[model samples]
Structure formats: structure tokens, C-alpha cells
Target chain A: MKKFLNDPVNFVDEMLEGIYAAHPMVTYVNDDLRCLVTAKPKAGKVGLTTGGGSGHLPTFLGFVGDGMLDGAAVGGVFQSPSAEQMYQVTKAVDQGVGVLYIYGNYSGDIINFDMAAELADLDGIAVKQVVGNDDVASSIVGEEHKRRGVAGIFFIYKAAGAAAAEGLSLDEVARIADKARMKTRTMGVALSSCVVPEIGHATFSIGEDEMEIGMGIHGEPGISRKKLGAADAVVDEMMERIFNETDYKSGDDVAVLINGLGGTPLEELYILFRRVRQLLDARGVNLKHVWIGEFATSMEMAGASISILHLDEELDRLMAAPANTPFFKHVTG
Target chain B: MKKFLNDPVNFVDEMLEGIYAAHPMVTYVNDDLRCLVTAKPKAGKVGLTTGGGSGHLPTFLGFVGDGMLDGAAVGGVFQSPSAEQMYQVTKAVDQGVGVLYIYGNYSGDIINFDMAAELADLDGIAVKQVVGNDDVASSIVGEEHKRRGVAGIFFIYKAAGAAAAEGLSLDEVARIADKARMKTRTMGVALSSCVVPEIGHATFSIGEDEMEIGMGIHGEPGISRKKLGAADAVVDEMMERIFNETDYKSGDDVAVLINGLGGTPLEELYILFRRVRQLLDARGVNLKHVWIGEFATSMEMAGASISILHLDEELDRLMAAPANTPFFKHVTG
Candidate 1:
């Protein structure tokens, strides 16, 4: 478990310092809070805030920019940002229009961010909360609504970012983010586990020749552990489950994301997306857009996840909107 | 040397197939050639083209989007795209506004891409070429103009893509891309060598306690190899050389990119970037913008690089422009 750090405890602090040093256009609320605010806040646009555990480079923080998130509350590695931290970020990033609290659905994250949102409201800040529950692997067959949030949170970011970039109000931003979340579903698998730098050990274990099906981003055990299989088969199982959980139909336009869970190769993700595309094509699903790479990561775990979103005209337009942050940008069109 | 592939020979083909399946909006020129074109190519906009080996995922392919590149010509893993392949891509992507050829500088890449540009011009398709030579490690101190191109090519894509997206003519886009090359410089080090899937072995050699400085992205050995040192010390040596070789001044505004070669963790890139910022700040250098991640990968090697660019007003505007590709997007005001 070799790493490039002097002390494990200094990891987050040093990382944030470097991020700030590299990007002088962003402001840090405080060391204790671990909140980042835009250097130049938009006067009337709804402020967007998101945060979670660290290690998923570019997920919450990477998406911060003009159109994405105005602020991000960062926690420890694979740990939730504190309630106080989220509150500070909300206040710092908020404009007269208000702020949107978008985040994943982990128990710790939900409790903390929920508390932050309440606190913001008491402080005379209009803050709306939206929890992304798009992970099909975290729910039972009949409990799709209970799914946890995973990489699918990226779509929420895109939607919220686009809306806010368009100068939407807090209500409009929340609505678009929630709508994007409803249309999105994701599932991940881990072929190998990762070592947390702070802990200096593997978070979980997997046999060299075996893989865990529907693994969570933090290396949490999935519904089943199975032998590593062919790319097509893996994609089929993952996409089929996601497809079954979502109300996708033939001729329905959608955007697909094949994400590397930190350590997986782009080669593998592309392969997974290929199989996913084939399956969708067989079902007569119309694929309108696709993204493949490490959008959301979990340390250095060799795994990948698939996210499918049935798109509407609004979502599609938002998808094409411009965004610029340290780790992401969507300005092509 | 573990990899996920059925056969070595099928690596590139399968990867291409998988990309096509994932994004229906992207279609390749030929079933055999890895020249990916946008599903909807805009008319009257100067077409942008970039291509390189497969290992640098998102570099050549991940960048094909509306404001970015129109098409990408992919070669084998760490191999150069053939002249004919580039020629085919130019023809397929050209919208009657001419084509801009932007690629990295390596012997094979230069030869092949140059040949392609010549062919395109001979066919009466206005073609412009700009070779990226930004790797400060490969150049002599007194002759900085002879530097090689490494991971800094990603910036080239963004700047050029933004210009083309704004409907810049081929000549103007070429000039901007060339200016970006002049402003950029990169230097990389390897803690571990990368293994090409097809070779089933590493492309270079490194001991458990050794490191290579000034290595090429193809796993080629660096100019020197020595015992590994602390992150700060290692970065200091790299940055001093890079800074000394360029026109960057203490108060000059610059863009910093700390790119992981492939297998290194984001945690490490942070540590390295921390030291890098400190060194730059101590010298009175101002970092206007920064990006740290696996933007340009080289298989799954455990290494990283530092890229610095002196941003002029035009370069800054171009750098701040929006880009929409699979891996990167930047929408700006």
C-alpha cells in the first residue's frame, strides 16, 4: 500500500491546499469546514452545492465551475462531509436567488446534508435539497425508489449545473436535478479492491480470479460475489438490471455513462458500454448520447459502473449546456 | 501484467466496437479504422482532427465533441495512427471549412500525421497542421524549442476545440493551436512501468525502489534513472527544469496541470501538486488555473507529470472557452 503522503491525517488538508493553489479562482470557506466557494459568485443564479466522501475525484469537487456547483463540502476519504461544513458552503455560495443542495443518499451524507439544509433555512437562506437515489444495486426488485446514489449523481450535477447556469431559481434547479435523478439508474461491479490511504489497507477483499457483483463505490459487498466473467456478459447483467429497474422504452432518447470506479481502465468501460449498447439496441432503445471514463471514482479500485438516463427535451438541452470546473467541462456545443 | 482481454490482437478492435456501441452519436469512418466522427457534424465550421495511440484514452477520442474535435483517429496501444487513417478521417469530418490537424510530437506520429495533412491538401481540402512539442524533459536547456510533446497535448485540444467551436477558420485555429504549444511545457516521471496488453509485459523496467525521470508516455525509459525520492524533492527537480526552460516569470499568470501517467492515485497527484504549488509560489509564480488528474494516461503505469502554460489574454480566453467531449467539458462566460 505505497502512497505519496507524509502523514495520513494531513491528506485532505494538503489535497485541498493544492486544489486551491492550482485554482485561485475558487475560495475555501475554512480548513475545519472543508467547503469551497466560487471566487466570483454569480449575483442572481441559484447557487448549487454538493459534497460527499473524498477519493471520488471530480465527482463533487471536480464538477464545481461556472455552470456546475458553486460550492462543494468535502469530507474525509470515503466519509461524509459534516453538517457544519455543508452549511458554511451553502451560505458562502448562495446568491439572492437561493441555493440547491444536491448530493448522494448515503446514510451519513443524508443526515449531515439534511441538517445543513435545515440550518440554512433558519439562517434566512432559501435552500432546497434533492437526494439522488439512482443505484439499482442498492435496492430490491420492487423497491427501486429505495436505491442509493452512486455515479448517477453526475447526471444530477449536470442538470442542476445547467439550470443554475441558465440563471434558474432554487426551485427550478431542484426540479431539474430531481427529474434527472428519477430518469437515471446505475450499478457497479468490482474486480479488485482498493486500499484507503489513511487506513493503509484494503477496504474489502476479492479473490484474484473473482469479482463482486453490484459492488458499492466504497468497496461495500454487493448482492453477490461471482467469478470474473466475459465483458459482454458482465455488461449484459449490469445493464439488464438497470434497464429492468428503469421505465425505458423503444425509441425513447437516452444518455448512457460508462464510468470507471477510480481504478478501472477506460478500455474496460468502453467494452462494458459496447455490450450495454448492443443490449439496448436489441430492445429497440434509442441511445442519444454517451460518456465513458472516470467521471466518479472510488480510490484505486478496478471496477466499472453503467448509468442510463431516459432524456427529455429539457434534460437533453441541459446536457448540452456549457460547464467549466477544475475536473470537468461541457462546452462543446 | 494482468489485463481484461480475450486476445491481444482484438484489443483495439474490441475497444472501438465498444465505444461505437456506447455512443450512437459517434460513428467511425470505417469499420476497421478508428476514426470516430460526430453523429451530427455541423456545416461551415472548420473541422478539427486529433489522433494518437490507444493507451492515452480521452486524449484523441474522449475529446471529440461539439466545441472540441469533430473526429479522432485512434491507433493501436501506444502506436501512431496511420496516414491513410488520418486521411480518411479528414475527408469524413470536413464540412467544407477545411480541417485542422492537431497531434502530439513523436517520430511515428509526426511522420504519419504530416503525411495525412499533405494528402488532404493535395485533395483540395484546406488542411493545417500544428505539432505539439511541449515536453520540457526531452529538450536541452539551451534549445527549448526542440522539446517533445507529452501529456500537455490535452490543453491543445481544449484551446483548438474552443476556437473551432467558435467557427475559427483553419488558419486561425492552426495559429492558436500553435500558440498554445508555445505556451505549454510538460515533464513526466515513472514509479512503475506500464504493460501493453498486447505485449503481456511492461514497456520498460523499473526497480521497486527506483524511479525514471523524463520518460516518454510510451513507457520508454527516461533520460535518467535513480533511487526514488520524496514527492516534494522529485517535483522540485522536475519543476525547476520546466520553469527554467520556459519564459514563465514569478508574477506571470499560468495554468498548471498535474497529470497522472495512468496508475498513480489522485491522492498522490495532490501531494505532488502541493509541492509544485509551493515551489512555484516561493518563486513568485501565480497559478491562474490548474487541472490535476488522469487526463492523458499511458496504460496503467504508476507515474505522473507536471505541465505549465503561460497564459496570454488570448490563450486565457481560448483556455477558458467551453468544450464538450466524453472526458472534458468547459462552458465559460
Candidate 2:
């Protein structure tokens, strides 16, 4: 495999060491290297925590900072963090208020986080959980809750983190997070598969001239694979799936994110955003905010995803709230 | 070519359209589709304008926002923007104070920007220029002016933009920009070449097991091409060259940037940064700030560059100044 790595066996440890060395605002919680906590945690506020596999950056760790996640449990590439790691992070970040865990709706994450919550309960530290299920391509129309979580976790993190920063109770923060997840929809198109470091090869094979619509972040089988078409046409298919899954209406205010799956450049993300804007305008969907970059990604995967969040007044305000992290920073106007 | 594009001929125009559509804080100049200007220009402040080939994002266009560049003139992929385009952006951003032009030290860019400065001078708008020559591998010792600029343009933008935002005069801002450029040093390695959309093929070729050290952003020949080594060994070679070129002292404070050339994953970047931090620590060079991401990219090239800026007190404050752009946001403490 052509990768900038020393050894596949040490990839996770080296990456975590690098992350800790690079970011001064965050540090390991106690002796548990798997859990990273913000250095300056706000008092009398609900502690927000998230965890998942390592490949999707700016998801769990990148979101750990002021006005966002208070801590994160990082696992190996595409592998979920253990329940013990999550439990330690929960105990470390709880500032007498409580802690809320927000993560993607993957079976591994759900199982681990639930176990962590139960463990935390024994210590009298209240812990709430919200599993993001915004990937519309993962399930049928009436089974939105069964869908896999994707880039829409960004919206959930922003909304729930804002609520927590406002000193909301753990339950209230969880409610807002759940609301954000329900309103957000995402669909992805993969031009190529990503190689896991340990695997040393692509998780799946795709032809040069072919593309998979509705592919999961972990290379799960998508709705269909077809001849790769123009940028606008591929975006159109993704958008149609999202619209059909969500209750998007004319004149509704929304936030849009055109996310790159690692290998894609910002130039292509903007190209894809242009088509997204054109289609949304025709449908009378007002874009209140638009983010175009790699918020979450599969390691070196060449593709993109579109995520739309139907914003209410509260959601709009929360989305606009200030956040300062390694990967994301939003200053309040 | 496997790319997410529509018509190769219209790639630049379409990308600009997408940028203007996605960012509400920036708008195209009147009658100049290639020029992007901030919607709300701070009056009396020296206008900061930057431009170059279109492929390196967050370098030019992504730096145009509040507390950053007042305007950007975008060009075709790996092709410099015309003199007329730069002239138009200069005219749009100048607010009677003056304008400072900061761009990479490339033949086409220097020629075009110089022409535009002359044109602006005819219209009574004072224009000062600072050509970035931070790529240490591009030239020999005492010939820094002949070196090409790479990821170090990011430091130039932050320092000069901060100076201008502080209401410094044109000459002062230009002086600060020049100082930033002089203090910055960068070295890059490339595992693969980037493809220009119109070219429909890689700009250069290398063997699967080979890597090019000190390669330019636009596929210029590097110092050497050899068998790819481990990540730490590669980083050590790059850092040794940087230390040899610059007089980095034991107690000197420096800002570090590990920039991905579009296709490298964040995991690898941090892994690289881990070694960079170790080398600097052993040398006793204090790292005051660190940034790791795709700052200046070559479309979708799979590699990375290291930039080190030896910072004094003034440079430190300016680097920490508040700036809010799509790709970069530094919140003042």
C-alpha cells in the first residue's frame, strides 16, 4: 500500500500521539490514552462527548473543544472505541452537571456507548445518548431510524453542543441532538474505495469509470453502481434521495454541507455545491448556511456527500453559535 | 481522467460560480467574473489582495473574508490569472488608503500582478507588492528571492492581513508581509503528480515505489526522486533541509504547518507532525502554534509539505489575531 505510514500495526498509536502533540488545547484524560478531554472544561454545564472509528476526522476528536464536545474516545481506524474508554471519558468530563454521548448509529458504537452509559450510571454520573441516523441511503423510507449515520453528525454536534453550552440539562441536550438528527439527511457517492491501514488494500473494488451512489462511509454496498456521470448528475441523484427521505418543503430554511470523503479537493466540493445550490433554488429551499469541506471522511476515499438540515429558529441559532476546535471554528456574529 | 468535473474548459468558471454561491461574505467584482471581493470591506484599512493559479485553495480565494484579504483574483487550474483580472480586484478593494498585493513568486503571477499594479497606479490607487519566496528547496543560500512559494503563503496571509486589519498603512502592511515571507521556510515531498482538468492526465509521472522530494506546487522538478521511505524518515529528511537552510535558534519561537497536498489523509498528516514536533523539540525550537490540514493543495496530489515560520513578538500577535474565513478562523483570546 502506498501510504505515509511507518508501520500498519502502530498507525493508531502514532496518530493519537501526533494529535496530542499538535493540539495544545486538548489532552489525554488520566492514563487512558484513548480518551481526549478539552483542557479547559466549562463548569456547571452539560459535558458533551462523542466517539467512533478514527478514519472520519473532525468527527469525534476535531469536535472536542469549547462550545462543542468536551471529550472524545478515539478508536483504531474504522474500529469502535471500547466501552471502558468511553466510560473513562464520561467520568472525566462530567462537571457535576452530567455527560451526554453523541455518535453515529453504527452497531459497534451503539453497543459500546450503551455499555459505557450503564457503567457511568453505577457511579451516579448521569449519561444520555443520541445515535445519529441521517444517512438516507442505508434504510427504506419508513425506517429512518434504521439508517446509518454519516456527515449529518456535524449538524447534531453543533445543535446539541450549543444546547449544552447554554447550560441545558443532559436530557435537554439529548433532546436537541435527537431533533437535529431527525431533521438532517445525507447521501454519498463514491468514485473509489478507501484502504484501511491494517487491511493494506481497498475495502471494496470500483472500476475507474464507475461510481457507487449511496455508498456507506465504511464501504458498505450502496443502492446501485453505474457509469460515472457528470458532477451535476451525480449530485442530482444524491439530492433526490435526500429529498425523498426528508420532509423538505418549499421556502423552508436549511443548512447545507457538501462534504468531501478524504481524497476529494475543495475545488470539487465547490463544483458539487454549485449544482446543489441550483437544485435547491429551483425547489425554493432557502439555504441559511452552507459548509463545503471535509468535516467527516473515510481515509483517502475519493468521493463526496451532501447533507441537508431543515433548520427551525432554535436550530438556526444553535448552528450559528460559537465553536473553537482544531478542525472547526465558528465565531458568533 | 477520473475527476468530478463537467466541461474541462469551463472548470475555472464553474468553480468560481460555486465559490460565489456558497460564500455570502464574498462576491464577484462588477464586470469581473474572476475577481472575488469581500461583501463588507473595512474602511480606512489597507486593502489586502492575493491571487495566483486556481488549484491552491485556501491560499488565495479561501483567504478572502473579514480580517483577511479584501479580494482575490482567481485563475485557471495551474494557470495565472490575467492582468485585467488582478487590476479589477485591486480597483474593487482599494478604499483610498492603498492596496497590498501578496502572491506566490511565480513568473506568470509576478508579471501579471506587476502589470496590474502599474494599471492601478495610473488610476491613482497605490499598490505595493510582496512576492513570497518561502520554498527553501527552490533556490540556493542567499538566493531566497528566486525560490517559489508554497504553503508558507498561509503565514503571509495571516500576518499581512492582520497588519492591514489593525489599520496599518499600505507601506507598513507590505513591510510586514515581506518580513513574514522572509521568515517562512517550506519543503515538500510528492508521492504522485496532480492532474490539471484541461490536461486530462497527470502533470508528471513517478514510479509506484518512488517519491519526489522538494517538488513544487505545480509539478516543478524537485531536488531528488528516490525509493519511498518510512514516514518518520521522510519527515526527518525534510526537517533537516529546513534547519540547514534557516538559522532556527534553540530558543526561537516558531509556528508549524503540516500541509496536505490535497490527497493525503489527516491521519498521515498528524503522523508526520508527530515527527516534526520531535525534531523541533530536540533542537529546542519552541512551537507556539501548529496547523495541520490542506492549506495549499495541488488539486489531488498525494503528498504533504512542511512550513516553519520563525515568529517574533509582532508575528506572534498578528498570527493570533482574529480572522474569519471559510477555510481559516483564528479566534483572539
TM-score of each: 0.87, 0.98
lDDT of 1 at A294: 78
- Residue B256 lDDT, candidate 1, scale 0-100: 83
Candidate 1 C-alpha lDDT tens digits along A138-183? 8887776677788989899988898888877778888999999888
Cα-based lDDT at residue A322, candidate 2: 95
Candidate 2 lDDT tens digits, B1-333: 667889988888888889888877888886776888998888898999999989888777998987789999888898899999999999999999999999999999999999999999999999999999899889998888799989999999999999999999999999999999989999999998888999989999999889999999999999999999999999999999999877888999999999999988899999999999999999899999888999999998999999999999999989888999877888866
**What TM-score number comes out for model 2?**
0.98
Give lDDT tens digits, candidate 2, residues A1-333.
Answer: 668999988898898899899887899876877789998888898999999999988776998887789999999999999999999999989998889889998999999999999999999999888888888888998887789999989999999988998888988898899899889999998988898999999899999799998899999989999998889888888888888766768989999989999988789898999999999999999998888899889999999999999999999999989988888888876
Residue pairs of candidate 2 with colliding backbone atoms = none
TM-score, candidate 2, first chain: 0.98
Q: State model 2's lDDT.
A: 0.90
Question: How much of the true A–B contact set does each candidate keep?
Answer: 0.45, 0.70
Top-lDDT candidate index: 2
lDDT of 1 by residue, B50-162 (tens): 88889877677877876788888899988888998999999999998899888887778888988888999888899888888887777786676566678898878778888
- Tell me the lDDT of model 2 at B27: 89
